[model samples]
Target: MQQSNAYIITFSIILTVILGLLLSGTSQVLGPLQRKAEELDTRKQILGAVVDGETLRKMKANEVLEYYQNRISSIVVDIEGNKIETAPDGSPMVAEKVNVGKNYKMPAEKRVFPVFIYHAEGNPDAVESYILPVYGAGLWDEIWGYVALKTDLNTIAGVTFAHKGETPGLGARITSSDVQARYQGKEIFDETGTLQAVAMQKGEGKDYDADKHKVDGMSGATITANGVNNMVKNYLQYYSAFLEKTKSAKSSDVVALN
Candidate 1:
């Protein structure tokens, strides 16, 4: 016997409801783990500044977390370089708790930036380098990555860039090792101490270190190249306040020792 239209309608409705409920339940069950995975991926990207990609990709999840928790030191600071230990509401402010994706939504002055200090291999207390999270507009969408600075804070050790939807083999080349390698040994400050963040002009890096502010730009991706230049310059200026303060303190200690 064929079912009536009424019966079919009722069955369809019930089936839809059951599937909806099941999907919702599954999402709820997997939500925490999904978020945890995403956070670890972000950590991996941040670690790209110091750790090579090949090693990062081969590491296990718990190993990555253990390495980050032990070898890395994180701190949150305002745009002015002041460390923030308490939120305005009196709650604890922790660097690991900062959501940089969300924090980017805030205004420039209100933004809370996170700095990751990667300690030396055998010295947990000595910072081998500093990593700063950087984000900005790209030719097609948002671009971001981590920039690592040497202990002097003037030399750029390395950079790792990623984009939302940049064209493959073109703008996406920003993530390529060949492109990122152009930043190595480049200084962000001039001899006179003025901030001169690296510039990406095609083929200009043959003269690398000549200007102290230039890097080899990606071929055939001028817009993305300009975006990178601005991203580095603006973010470097924002982080400079903090580096200057730290540099001054170190100078004072040396003076006392002398």
Candidate 2:
């Protein structure tokens, strides 16, 4: 009986060590591939947000590479609106800000990819808009997305919301086509130049048109939607100087090229 007990203990130890080795090896082998997959998924979401249904369906990593190569220009900008450096073509670059409490423990230089999609036209004045990257914390996890606005930087052209995890049918409403569509063509700034963060207020009694920059808050998910509203306002405030610069450039007919 003592020998049997000893054999069982030995077997348990051996199994534990074997499992540990297998897990470590598997993680090492799959880490790069996992990262690559995430990168591709992010690209897909960004492209889907900007492109139409047909165009987005046709988009692949190689196609996205070509599109970015031909039209987009990427540059890293610091918190103070100073341009840091132009990133390498076709490489994913990180934003200069980090959200620590939201599980992004990485340094500012390591979190969030800031990609700029430039609209190219035969006539320099016909260029469309600039897309800015924004991210922040939701109730349960990290929320991230791209917001494309017109050249004026006052009107939103499109937005895409993605989250790590949030209550289904509640916070998840942020990613719904209907919810996201509400942000399309919404004004980001009032004529008085005040930034009114969009809200998901309850009831239809509130007048959004009168408010100019207001949006109807998501029903049943007020808190999560409010989180989104705050994120947009705060993140955009950080880029105010950059937006001002871009607006100023528009007045002076400065055209960015790839």
Candidate 3:
């Protein structure tokens, strides 16, 4: 009987070791593929922020990269309007010092690649806009997205939100098409030029004075939607300087050449 018991215990130990080995090997093999999937998803979100209507449906990962390559000019600028680096090839680079605020010097390859998309057949001297990336925590997990602004830098051209985990039908609505559409053409600032991040309120008819810069919150999804609003407002503050510089540069070009 004791010999039989000993055999059972040994078998259990071997099984556990085998399972562990299998899991570890699987993780190693799938890591690169998983990363590729994430990169593709990010590219899709960035493209989605800029396009409208059926154009979004037609966009694929390769198409996104191609469009960005043809239209977007990437540059790394300091908090003070000085150019730290510029990618002549327009290849996207990982933003390493993103969270370091505006104090640190962004490395040549580590700078945030701000994609500037020009309006089709629009004024050649017009400063179209820029899309900036934002990432932060939500109630259940991490959320990330892009916010595109007009040349005025006070208006929202478009926005796209995505999350790692959230309760479906509740917090996950942050990324829903209906929810994202609400932000389109929304002004981030008021007529007086004050930055007022739109909020997520509950129930009907909240006072969103046109001069105050506010939007109606998502019904039944207040917390998650508020998370979206806060993330945009906070991160955008960091780019205020960069926005001003871009506007000035565009103005100078308009005056000198045109």
Candidate 4:
């Protein structure tokens, strides 16, 4: 039996409409869950810079959120290192909400940097570390990370890196624990107080143990290594003013104690 052309067209249109409605309904139902998951992931990444990944992986999502809420406080600073309570457009500024990737597209002077402060477990007044977020271009795409500095504001406590796209087992190793561990305790400032930032040298299997500003390079991933080096150097430079201010305040405190 041959179907009439009008009947076939109407049937096709109804089917298309039904499928569209189903997709729309699914999106509406899952939207909040998806957003919640992304928020959790972001918090995890930020915490990963201060806490070890092994420990983070062992905890549940709610546990992670609770830990973050209890241990971390944050502030936003401009290019000049002034603490900003509001954004340029008069909106309240939240450190965790600042999009570093979006700020990367804006002019440097117009950008706001977010600083995450990790507090000692029992003492809120005692700051254990300051975690700064950095974003930059990788060999294949965008890369970013959180770098935690010790109380001295010079030594790296830990780092957590991520990327949009990169070759598997090559440049992608930037997220590996071994690679991140290499940055621990590395100094970003020289003896003269000049910000040197940490650098990942070419190749691997060399002893950078004695050097305060050098880390082991990724094997066969020179471009990615260079990207990491530049990202660290550039973001450190961007945060130099804030770092110096913090160092000065610490020195004053020491002097007062003496």
Best prediction by lDDT: 4
Which residue ranges in model 4 land beyond 4 Å of their true spot? 1-25
Model 4, range 1-258, lDDT digits (tens) per residue?
Answer: 899999999999999999999999999999999989989988998999999989999999999999999999999998888899997789999998899999999988988999999998756679999999999988999999999999999999999999989788999999988899999999999999988999998989898999999998988999988898899899989999899888898899999999
Ranking, lDDT, top scorer first: 4, 1, 2, 3
Report how far residue 21 has shifted in candidate 3, in Å. 2.6
Judge candidate 2 against the unseen true structure and give its global Cα lDDT, from 0 to 1: 0.66
lDDT of 4: 0.93
Residue lDDT tens for model 1, 1-258: 899999999999999999999999999999999999988988887787888778888999999988888788888888889888887789988776776667778888998888888996547569889999888889999898889999899998888998999999999999887788778888999989999988899643365656667887777898999998888888898898889987898799889999
* Model 1: lDDT to the true structure: 0.86
Query: What TM-score goes with each of the models?
Result: 0.85, 0.76, 0.76, 0.90
Best by TM-score: 4
Model 4 Cα shift for residue 117 (angstroms): 0.3
Better of 3 and 4 by TM-score: 4
Q: Which 10 residues in a row give candidate 1 its minimum summed lDDT?
A: 203-212
* Rank order (by TM-score, best first): 4, 1, 2, 3
Steric overlap count per candidate: 0, 4, 0, 0
For each candidate in the order shown, give its overall lDDT on alpha carbons: 0.86, 0.66, 0.65, 0.93
**Alpha carbon deviation, residue 177, candidate 1 (Å):** 2.5
lDDT of 2 by residue, 163-183 (tens): 879789978878776677667
lDDT of 3 by residue, 107-154 (tens): 423434344454433344444666777666677877777888877777
Pairs that collide in candidate 4 are none
Give the higher-TM-score candidate: 2 or 3: 2
